[model samples]
Target: MKQFFLTLAGVFAGLVLFVIVTPIALIALAAAGSSAPATSPNTVLELDLREGLTDQPPTNPFAAFGGAELSVIEVVDALDRAGDDRNVKAVLIRLPEMGMTPAAADEVRQAVRRFRASGKPVIAHSQGFLPVGAVMSSYMVGASASELWMQNTSSFQATGFAADEVFLGDAFGRYGVTADFEQRYEYKNAVNTFTESDFTPAHREAMLSWMRSIYDSALANAAADRRQTPAAMRQAIESGPHSAEQAMALKLVDKIGQVEEAEAEAKRRAGRNAQLVSVADYVSNHGLQPGSGSDAIAIVNAEGAIVTGRDAGGGFGSGSTIYSDDTAAAIYEAIENRAVKAIVIRVSSPGGSPDASEQILAAVRAAKAAGKPVVVSMGTYAASGGYWISSEASAIVAQPSTLTGSIGVFGGKFVLTEALGRFGVDLRGLSVGGEYADAFSPTGRFEGQDRAAFAASIDRTYDQFIARVATGRRLPEARVREIARGRVWTGAQARELGLVDELGGLHEAIARAKALAEIPADRSVRLIRYPTQKSPFEALSEAFGVSAEGAQALVAVGGVLASPEAQGVIARARTEQLRARGASVLADQPVR
Candidate 1:
């Protein structure tokens, strides 16, 4: 027994040593081998959207290790800087195939337009715009460029966005699984997936309303960028998938050729011997220095599903989760920071725990009380609990295509009594408390007092939600209730309904924050990340500080860092990260 203990201790010590030493070695090598090239005259900054864009730098250090992914903010800042850079003669972008979230695409398109206004031509090249989903969003950004290039024989099938919801009510019934869910109102359709096979009238109405709004925004923006009338552009896009040649013929694309030819064209347009540099690399080495000014706008990112407690360290099956504790801490830090003039909380969630949402909202209120105006910047979508946290912000800004406002509550669980009984497994409960003690038991369904209690809890949550929205938006309680039946709304719709203050992206949100704080428009203000983003090494140290599992994860990370497959892992991890940020099963459809 003593020998076994000694061996186990020795193994743990060895693992700790390996985890610490291997990463340091890998970091040193990565630094030495990947030195960014010096920015020189006549350089063409290459922005590759082929991998898509993340809203922000990754929060997890382990995930951060595998890739050098640049966020939308990073790209926007880099392009803006490059526009004034004498060294950067032009810009080139490789469009994504899978497409980007409408909000992210809009932000990049705005940046591209700004870059073009500097008299430096921006060229966009696309292999194809496959019609998987949100492909038109990819085309929207491409259309904003000085030249749109497509690969030979590639299809341009960026038709429109469509989401398919999976209804498991029938399946559950057949399998003897009872989905016992209750919602505050009919339009809170998240529970409908388990309760009904088809869309209810309210669900259909809400879905079409937001979908059409987003589609119109995409079409109008694309048409304006392509220099065509909205009617003509709508007719062209609605007319099935067009070939690259057909797109060129219809003036939907500027040029058609292989990727190499497109590159040559970009080089030609850039004058002579213009070197192509990765925008990610350029930004890492020379992007706008954050926190460079005396006065700062602290950005607290509340991304993923709103939940209680601290981050779970992103273990297996752990998608993006915004812990209330972490989010509140970030907001409180900003409130206490003397240099912070205002706070901008970037939210991209579809809702989660109501209690968690309230916790975060309290922090936002605390910031306001401290004289630091709090502005909300909605990304992709921020519905239900997402909106709950945002309701009291000093100002709310969202992209036209962003989905927000699902002011409702729903809660319940799957009753597996019959299913388990059929399998000869009984999940019986032995309770010594009141009758409602078995209310949440998997083997029992809510009945009598338990049912009444559950219904009351749900109603309380709903009432609180509507009251908060009414108070925050300064609307009447009746007016809030009329619009609140848990229906999701597009940012454009929300703006019209007075749910959101403005329709814009993070850039505009920052501007709003500046105005509220009385900062001059012309003066540059330092942007500080709330919760204080740590260096990769610092995060790694914290990760390893936790447990043996963290050590094992670090070891796996070391293997990845040392291997050539690190790039591929980075791409996959980034996709997962984006999904966690944008995909929610609560209120809005998945963005991209």
Candidate 2:
């Protein structure tokens, strides 16, 4: 019996070792075999926008396993390089069915325009366009190309923007649940989703403000590309969904055919024997690091909800979530690096924890004290806590459609006493010392002195937020207060209101950083990204403790659970979990 048990233990140990080593070996072999291919003469660069883009590169390599993943920076840099490459002739882009965010579309469209300026043709092909999301943004990008093509059967659904939200107040009331929340002012409507049945007056006004700004900007840009007046473009697009043939008649699209025909046209433009090379492949072959020099501009990415403590690292079936400690540490590291001349922090968040925002804001101040000028580049949305950390930057740059400036705070919790009673699940509470010790108890209501105390704390936080913005932007306290009232603004409106310094994207931010650091415009400076990405091998080693149980967990995580569909579900779940935890300074604006 003792021998049998020992043999079983040995077999289990071997199985664990095999399970661990096999994947590592296979991945290593795959990496070894996948050498970068050389670019041939007269190659046409093909870029597919169907794969969504993020602000920063994936934290782990395994993220590239299922499909090609590209960041906005990567796509822009690749096009910039390809424009100058003599071997590259033309570019082909495949548009998505749904659409992209307004900011992302603007950035890529600018790059496309720059590429077209080099006298090379850019052909954009769309399989179809849906009215589900920001379809107009996608059309704006396609219009930037030298020629736009749509599938024969595809419909052009570039209608105006509209926002729809589902409020849970009535449902919760029917179920005997209570949602108690407080805001510093009237404009902070995030809590309204839970406490009210529909959009409040302030909410409707704020939504319309940003949506109108985006609509106008998109029309103007697309009109410039198509050589038509903004009013004419708007009239044509707003005139209901157009069929492919109808779009051609209206001059909305230059050509109509299948995607394959579009590809053939691009290749024909590239001359005979021209190969269609993927943008990813081209980038991999010829590395396109922005610059290289002794002096460097550090890029710290703060994308996702800002919570306290170290980052969860977003490994295996997870998405990006910003952690305060990690972000602050990255800024500190940039400040400490002697070679670092300036810092450009890319921010893409709707805000998170108040404490975390304060911590990161302090780091930004410290970097300035160390003589490293900091420039903020706002992504899709940077409101509430996101704006908090960016308030003191040397300069702030944002896209015309970027949502920002929700300068307010809120705090409260739900009372589940009635809800639990309905389910016959009573939650009893016990107190130890202070009378208000159980005030935060989930089963009870927040009232009396305790509620007042909580409200006071929120008021103090809001005051601090306004003060920070006033000092950073060099505006009067009265002016800041007028804009504070928890209001949100688009980047264009924020610029006019003296909230944001410039209206542009990452490229503009980097240029401003160079000017502030006294670096010459003609000189090249290396870009060093902070909170550096980890290798898959390193991530795996840390994730799995090399034990049998860890190996088992790895297998379970990597199997059907790692599929693209499954990972998306897991990512949404993780986002909701993080959102709930970081609601203190949150100004969440759901993508339309």
RMSD of 1: 10.0
Residue 547 in candidate 1, Cα distance off native in Å: 11
Report the CA-based lDDT of candidate 2 relative to the real structure.
0.83
Alpha-carbon RMSD, each predicted model: 10.0, 10.4
**1-592: candidate 2 lDDT, tens digit per residue:** 5544554465455434344444653474365457755568888999998988876665665655534477777788889888888888999999988868888888899889989999999999997778867788899999999999999988988878877888999998988778887797899988888899989999999888888998899889999999999988998999969899988888889999988998999999999999999887776565446588878999998888889999544245336677899999999999999999999999999999989999999999999999999999998889999999999999999999888999999878888888889999998899999877887788877889988887888889999999999989999988998988888998999999998999888888999999999999888899888877664445555444454446445554555553557656654554465455552324333211
Candidate 1 colliding pairs? none
**Cα distance off (Å), candidate 2, residue 52:** 1.6
The list of candidate 2 runs beyond 4 A from truth reads: 1-36, 65-68, 284-290, 312-314, 546-592
The TM-score of predicted model 2 comes to: 0.87
Per-model lDDT: 0.82, 0.83
